[model samples]
Target: MGTRLVPSGRTATRLLQAAIGVVLVEGLLLQNPGVVVNALLSLGVTFLPPVLARDWEVRLDTRLTLYIAVAVFLHSVGMLGFYESVWWYDHLTHTLSATVVAGVGYATAKAFDEHSDAVHFPGSFLALYVLLFTLALGVFWEVLEFGARLLATAVGMDPILFQYGIDDTLLDLVFNTAGAVLVALFGSGALRPLVESLTTRFDRSFGER
Candidate 1:
């Protein structure tokens, strides 16, 4: 058997970007407003890493950039029937998305802890804090999903978001917790660069003020 070649980070990113564009065109052809909107939004989000690096000087390495892109791409594709057709698609997306949320929470809080003398977090406490932060965002997302479904039903329009049920909601939260735990345990090392960058940015902004 021939060896398979793995794509480079930049190559994979470009392929995903092109795939998202295809999804956007598919949405337009199908006349599905929900898919169209989600695709458009996700396409915009994929550009945020470079934008932040350029405008804010908050640089994210390729891994984190690809992390965000993967989550956004999965969710955008889920809008096109994967959530209904593929059994674990929702779970996978939720877990991945939760990682992004947990990463942000950890990075921001850790940056603040490092940047401020008054704010201090022990390692254990920071881990717990990240879990709570992710869970809180997960709850908010579920609420938004439920609200969207309710509003759509009231208006007799298709819902942009879906609320599966209590069981699914609970499972989503469970997966979210799993993702948070992974980040808490292993993300600190991988996330150090981001934390340092954020800390520097915070320091500069405060110094200016």
Candidate 2:
């Protein structure tokens, strides 16, 4: 039998339906239109990439990617609300951290699968890779933020709008590194088996075996 394929349109439609369901659930539970709308919007944005990239060559699992994206989006939104400001630094840091974790997690999973025949790298090495990549991403984000601020200034917008002090940037890097380490230590072990099981079940359900 040939591999079963899920049509991209079907994937998109399913994600949209799921978002609507979340909105309905939120409305029923909280009776708050604002909360419901926010949840739907967040879900839509989080699922959009995976739904669109359903046929892409990327080995990242769509379901896991969507879950991580939603969690990151919600976390960033919460931070913005808590800080009472949408500073460029805050947004950049959050985006960097989220992207790093998701990217590293996906890459690590692939590496683990490929290296299954080889001796497994010590968990410490995996943790180090996660931290290093996250730190690198942090630096890249800072550079982007700086460039954005410079562009805003040149365009006669408030340069202060994107000014992320060195101290704040460093703090963000620290937190991002911490988050990466935690994900490596906990998420690696927890999510690996779960993803493997899900992948096996998905293949079996679709008669891809």
Candidate 3:
């Protein structure tokens, strides 16, 4: 399983990078600097962790890297204006991103965890941990969105906040939670093994904080 994953993981990573490059060019041609900003920011968010992981001596497999890229790819499309034109695009992206967030949290928890550790707990506690982790990240994202708006206002650009109103914000949170719970309840079983393998291959893991 591990051997099969490594090759496909690299393919996914390259495909994602190429697709994002296309999005970048598309953003540039449209002269929509905001889209360009969003795309670059998305790419940074997608890839920066792996870059830092290398320096920090933490393991990040190409499959996980591709997952991040897929999450950001959804955002790149949203930045291109599908979030407005398509009634459901916003929902889809939020759900996808939130699920990815949960995946990362699960991987991180698994990487750092030792059954022998005093901080470790069994059963529902781990599920709860992932849920809370996802929710906290969702809120943090909202905060960043608002912060970006504040910065935009200070720079004299139109505030992008509240574009979809309070309903948008609330719905985003709802979807985020839903995604997290779905992953916790179902997806984790399949994903955990792959993540465990990746972390083991690297031979580096985070300690409980």
Q: lDDT tens string, model 2, 71-171?
A: 54544344323333654545454644554464555454545544354435566776676677777777886777688678866877543224357887776
Q: Provide backbone clash counts, one per model.
A: 0, 0, 0
Better of 1 and 2 by lDDT: 1
Which candidate do you rate higher for TM-score, 1 or 3? Answer: 1
Badly placed stretches (over 4 Å) of model 1 are 1-7
Estimate the lDDT of model 1.
0.88
Q: What would the per-residue lDDT of candidate 3 be over residues 153-178, giving only the tens digit for each residue?
A: 79987444324557888999999998
Residue 151 accuracy (lDDT) in model 1: 95
User: Candidate 2 — what's its lDDT?
Assistant: 0.53
lDDT of 2 at 99: 49
**Model 1, span 1-209: residue lDDT tens:** 00111358778878888999999999889888778888888889888877877778887767787878889999999999999999999999999999999999999999999999888999999999999999999999999999998998999878888999999999999999999999999999878888988888999988522
Candidate 2 backbone clash number: 0
> Which residue segments of model 3 deviate by more than 4 Å?
1-8, 45-63, 158-163, 193-209
Candidate 2: stretches off by over 4 Å: 1-45, 57-66, 75-106, 109-120, 158-161, 193-209
Taken over the whole model, the C-alpha lDDT of each candidate is 0.88, 0.53, 0.71
